[model samples]
Structure formats: structure tokens, C-alpha cells
Target: MLRVGVVGVGNMGRHHARIYSELSKEGEVEFVGVADANLERAKEVASQFKTKAFGDYRELIGRVDAVSIAVPTSLHKQVALEFIENGVSVLVEKPIAESIESAQEIIRAAKKNNVTLMVGHVERFNPGVLKLKEILDENLIGKVVTLTAKRVGPLPPQIKDVGVIIDLAVHDIDVMSFLLERNVRKVYARAGSAKNPLELEDYAIIMLDFENATGVVETNWLTPHKVRTLSVVGTEGIAELNYITQKLILYNHEWVKEAKVQFKEPLRNELEHFVECVKKEEKPLVNGEEGLHALMVAIKALESANKDEAIDVEFT
Candidate 1:
């Protein structure tokens, strides 16, 4: 069984802990231990799950085969590199690292260690997205012509680690790249801080151009309502995905009306897939390269916003 340790017990980290605990209970993996800077919080989570707790993550590296890192963006490189250097597989929460250079270092370390390095771009596992991908693959959409996404919600101040672009909009950018399966030619964005004092943006609008079409994303933490919506316009039909409800809708002239479908919880599905990958030693759908590509586009968007000019994503 794969021995798993989770570092960080914050909001998203807590979910990772619970999922790891459940995986262990299901006999798919072993719950090695958990670490958090907040000793009390770590102890509490450990006690709840009947696992050991560590104040320092380094202490658990030798004991676990793999680790799920849910720490802040700033600490992603430090934490991931530590475990990766010791030949431990890692599932790091998304945006890979705070910058492209750091992300490259983490990727390099994992490559040198020959350990699995996956990013937690959980939306890639969403059933709705999977079904949409199926339709696209079948040419049911008749070649996607344009794409747009709106990921907005009331401020979750606890997520001050990264800006809305990295924290929220990166999902759509990643999804757009997956859906189109092409290299983006150019990106333009505008963003500003809403409340936080840091340079991190709370509201942003991004645009990406591909060979055949364009994609747009509006992400913000200032919206009054929670909305995770994506609308894809293809030559044949338009598809809408409501991420919050796991519902999908397709509109076409041939249908006479729009068709709608609902799916189960994506988070559970995502975790199940992760467990399967670990058990099978298989490459995950959203691997480090995919995550890095998304980050590259996001960083360009940030640069575009800062310079007030369209920036081209330079692929390495």
C-alpha cells in the first residue's frame, strides 16, 4: 500500500486529509501522518483521523512514499522540493509554484528523483468536463469556435495566498487548453486588487487566442454569488457547464431544445482517480507538464495586467 502524508491542514488541506484518511480506510492506501505549522490544528486533524501529526513536514519524508502538499503558493517550492529530493511522489495543490522558475525547479527535482509529480487541477476530473470532452472528441460540437468562462464568488479572504487569476481563473485557462488541445498564441489580461494589501489581484479578466479560436475568462472574488460557469461555442452547438451543480447543458438547432445533464460530486471522483493513479503507478490526467503550461499562461496574464499590454506566452 502507498503510505501517504498530507502537509498543511488549512481549508483545502483539510479536504486532502479527509480524502487520504478515507482512502486508507478503504484499503487503497495508508495514512502515514500529517504536518502543519499550526500545531494545534495538525494535532486536531490527526486525532480525528487517528494518524500521527508533525509540526515539521521534513520529519515525515522518510516515512511516506508519497505526500499531498496543500500549503500556500509561496511555500509550494520549498515543501515539494524537500519531499521530491528524497524520491517521494507528490500531489501538490495547483498553480504549481509562485513563479515559472520555481515551478521549473520543482519539475526538475521530480524528474531527477524519478518520482510521480502531479498537480491538483481537480476540475480536469470533473465528470461534466469529462463528458464535454467526450462530446468534443466525437466532433459533436463540430470544432470548438470560441470559449468563455466566468468563475466568480464572494471573497474567501482565507485564500490570500494567491491572486484570483492563479487561484480561480487558472482553472478555466487550464480547461481551455485541455478542451482546445492547442498552444495559445497570445494572452491579454486586466486585474486589480480588491481588498488585500498584497500585489495579488482579486479581480481579473483574461483573453487567450488559439490558432482556430479564442477563449475568455472573468475571475473575481468580489462577486456576490458563487458561480462557476463555462460556455463553449462550437460550430455545431453550444455547451454550458455549471460547475457548482455539476450540471451540463447543450444547445443545438437539431435538438429543437437544449439538453441538460447532471453529474455526481466531482471532488470525490477526483480523489478516487488520484487513488487509482497511485495504486496503478499511472500518469495522472493533469500531470506536472499540464499544470506548468497552465501556470505559464497565467503568469503571462499577470504580466499583461501589470504592463497593460497583450503578452505572448513563450513556450520553453
Candidate 2:
């Protein structure tokens, strides 16, 4: 069994610890321990998962064969490098790092050490999204023309370091790239701070121009009710997905077809994939470069908004 641990037992980190513990029951992984800056919180999560706890994340380095880095955005590169440089595979949470340079450093370090680095772009594993991809591949949507995603909800208490673009828009940007299999060619965005007490932009409308198709993502924190949805419009039809409900629907001139998808928690699938990648020495579904591309797109969007102009996209 592969020995595993989790660092950062905050809202997202606890879920990672819980999933690792559950993966242990199948005999493929062992939940070694969990660590957090907050010792009491770490102990609390460790107890719930029936494992040991460490106050400092560094303590998990030598003991764990693999680790999940769920710390805040600013801490991603720092925490991830600690485990990766020690020859531990890591599943770092989304957006990889706050800046492109930090992301490049982490990727380079992982390559230097030959360590597996997976990003937690969990939406890629959602049942509905999986179905949507299958449908697109089967030409149900014909040639794609436009893709749009809206992910809005009340401001989450857990997000402090980054605004909605980095926190929420990146998810759809990554999803659009994954679905289209093309890098973004141009980016334009307009954002403003509405209800955010931190004076960071809490709402944004980002437009990405791919080689052939156009993509748009609208995200905000002012919505009273949570919304997570995506749609793809193509030559023949349109596909709609309700992310939370795992529901997909296709609309054509002739009729509308609602897909029947088998539901599985996206986080569970993501962690399982991370474990499989480590054990089999395989590349992840969302590798380091993919993560970096998403971060780059988001950063470009912010820059576009700041300059009040479209930014040409290029990933080196």
C-alpha cells in the first residue's frame, strides 16, 4: 500500500485527509498522517481520519510516499516543493501557485526530482463533465463555436489571498482548455470589487479566444444562491451541464436529450487518480503544465482587466 499524508487541514484540506483515509480501506493506500499550521486542527482531523497529526507540514516529508498539498494559494509552491524535492509525489490544489514564475519553479523542481505533480482541477473528473466530453468527442455538438461557464456563489470565508478570478474563474478556464484541447489565443476581461471587504475584485467576466472557438467565464460572489454551470455551443447543438447536480442536457434543432450520468464525488475521483498516478508512475490527467496554463490564463485575464484591453496569450 502507498503511504500518504495531507498538509493543511482547513476547509479543503480536511476533505483531502478524509478522502485519503477512505482510499485506505481499499488496500491501495495508507493514511499515514495529516499536518496543519494549527496543531489542534491537525489533531482534530487526524482523529477523525484515524491517523497521526503533525503541527508542522515538514514532519510529513520523510514519512509519506505521497502527499496532498491543500494549503492556501500563496503557500502552494512552498509547501509543494518541500514534499516534491524529498522524492514525494504531490497533488497540489488548483491554480498551482499565485504567479507563473512560482508555478514554473515548482514544475521544474518536480521534474528535477522525477516526482509526480498533479493539480486538483477536480471538475475534470465530474461525471457530468466526463459525459459532456464524451458527447463532444462523439460529434454530438459538431464543431464547437462557443463555450460559456458561470460559477457564482456567496463569498466563501476560506478565500483570503486571492480574488474570484484566481479562485473561481480558473476552474472554467481550465475546463475550457481541457474540453477544446487548444491553448487560449487571446484574453479580455472586466472586473470590479463589489461586496469584497478586502477590495479585491469579487466579480469578473473573462473572454478567451481560442484558435477557432470563443470561450467565456462569468464568476462573482454577489449571487445569493450558489451556481456552478457550464455550456458548450457548436455547429449542430448545445450542451449544458449542472456541475453540482451532475446533470447534462443536449439541445438540437430536432429535440432535447437529457443525459443519464452515474454520479461520483469529483474529489474522490481526483484523489484516487492522484494515488494511481503515483503508484503506476504515470502522468496525471491534469499535469503540472496543464495547471500552469490555467493559472497563466487567469493571470492574463486580470492583466487584461487592469489594462482595459485584450491581452495576447502565449505560454512558454
**Index of the highest-lDDT prediction:** 2
Q: Estimate the TM-score of every prediction.
A: 0.95, 0.99
> What's the lDDT for all of these models?
0.87, 0.94
User: In order, what is each prediction's RMSD in angstroms?
Assistant: 1.6, 0.7
lDDT of 2 by residue, 4-26 (tens): 99999899999998888888887
Best TM-score goes to which candidate? 2
Tell me how far candidate 1 lies from the true structure as C-alpha RMSD in angstroms. Answer: 1.6
lDDT of 1 at 55: 97
Q: What C-alpha lDDT does candidate 1 achieve relative to the native structure?
A: 0.87
What TM-score number comes out for model 2? Answer: 0.99
Candidate 1, residues 1-316: lDDT per residue as tens digits? Answer: 8899999998888888888888889998899999999989999999998899999999898899888899999999999999999988898899899899999999899888888888988888788888888878888778899999999988776787778998888899888889888877899999998775675798999999988889999999888999999999999999988877767778888773333445666656766776677667788888888888898899899999999999988775
Locate the minimum summed-lDDT window of 10 residues in model 1.
256-265
Among residues 3 or more apart in sequence or in different chains, the pairs in candidate 1 whose N, CA or C atoms overlap within 3 Å are none
Range of the 10 consecutive residues with the lowest summed lDDT in candidate 2: 21-30
